[model samples]
Target chain A: QQQVKQSPQSLIVQKGGISIINCAYENTAFDYFPWYQQFPGKGPALLIAIRPDVSEKKEGRFTISFNKSAKQFSLHIMDSQPGDSATYFCAARVYTGTASKLTFGTGTRLQVTL
Target chain B: SAVISQKPSRDICQRGTSLTIQCQVDSQVTMMFWYRQQPGQSLTLIATANQGSEATYESGFVIDKFPISRPNLTFSTLTVSNMSPEDSSIYLCSVASGTNSYEQYFGPGTRLTVT
Candidate 1:
């Protein structure tokens, strides 16, 4: 079963426009939600993350809007740029025993066109 | 964030052969993990490597097929035995760091192509 589901497998946005990607999870045990950006041939890098305590967390132009009640979250990129073109993955970490394992979404390929 | 590096950035091996990928972290960490990303697929956790203990593998993975060694906090190795074409994928090692520490930092990844 896919614990987390992401929408819009691929997205295209114009430079300076807003880019949004949505995700929903079924596991309430997930307390940590993180978004990762991955470039081709490279590993995924942590972009932004938020806990269930906060409804929104913003860092520069990247913002993560989370809804604890709905079990949903979305990533909004302000003023999207060509450099932002990459694959984004939404992940949730569930603590198991002494360690935590991260479950990732299918991923969204975003393209910013100038 | 922690700096992580993987040796043998990429390799091409024949079937039935084995390859060992090494991961090195700049700082010592308690929790380290190994993941595999197949062609056009998301990252899948293979095992958790902790120092001074047996590695804990996720379902669908076994120790004999993918042996892991975490001799110290700063380093670990993953060996893929009897590799086949289906084993061709990118192997990544990550370390948990930072204040939250649940967030993981990953290596560049070792791209393996088995024929």
Candidate 2:
């Protein structure tokens, strides 16, 4: 069972445009939502995250819009640049016992053109 | 956040052969996890490497197939036994940074190709 679902398998946007990727979770127990950015051969890097208490969180050019009622969240990149082109993943984590378990969504490949 | 390094960034092994991948973290962590990502697929949890105890395997994973060793808090090893072509994928090791944080830091994955 895919606990988290992400859309737009691939995306292409202009350099100055906004790139948006959406995700939804099935498990309501998930309290932590994080987004990761991965390059071709490197590990995924932490971008920005949000909890259910807040509806949005922004860091630099990246923004995360979350909706607790819909169990959905999104990553938005403003003034997209070519350097921002990479695969993005939305992940949810619910506190299990001593260790937490993460549920990841299928990745979205984002391409920003000049 | 802990910095993790994985050994043998990539390897190609024959069918029925086994390869052991090692993960080393800069700091001690309570939990270490092994994940597998097939070509163009999302990451799937293989097992949780527990310190001073047997590792906990996920539903589709088994101890014999993906044996894990967590002798200490800062180091762990995952062995893919009896590898087949179907076992070809990128294996990643991750750990949460702080007790109150929700972020996970991953190492550059080990790419295993079984022929």
The CA lDDT of each predicted structure is 0.92, 0.90
For model 1, state the Cα shift of residue A62 in Å. 0.4
Best by DockQ: 2
Residue ranges of candidate 2 with Cα displaced over 4 Å: B98-101
Kindly list the per-residue Cα lDDT of model 1 for residues B1-114, writing each as its tens digit: 889999899999999999999999999898899999986678999999888889999999999999999999899999999999999999999998532367888899999999
- Interface RMSD values for the candidates, listed in order? 2.4, 1.6
Return the lDDT, model 1, position B30: 88
Relative to the real complex, the DockQ score for model 1 comes to 0.59
lDDT of 2 by residue, B1-115 (tens): 7899999899999999999999999998878889998877888999877788898888999999999999998999999999999999999999875444577899999999998
lDDT of 2 by residue, A3-113 (tens): 999999999999999999999988888989999898888778888999999999999999999999998999999999999999998999987666788888999999999
DockQ for every model comes to 0.59, 0.67
Quote the TM-score that chain A achieves in each candidate: 0.97, 0.97
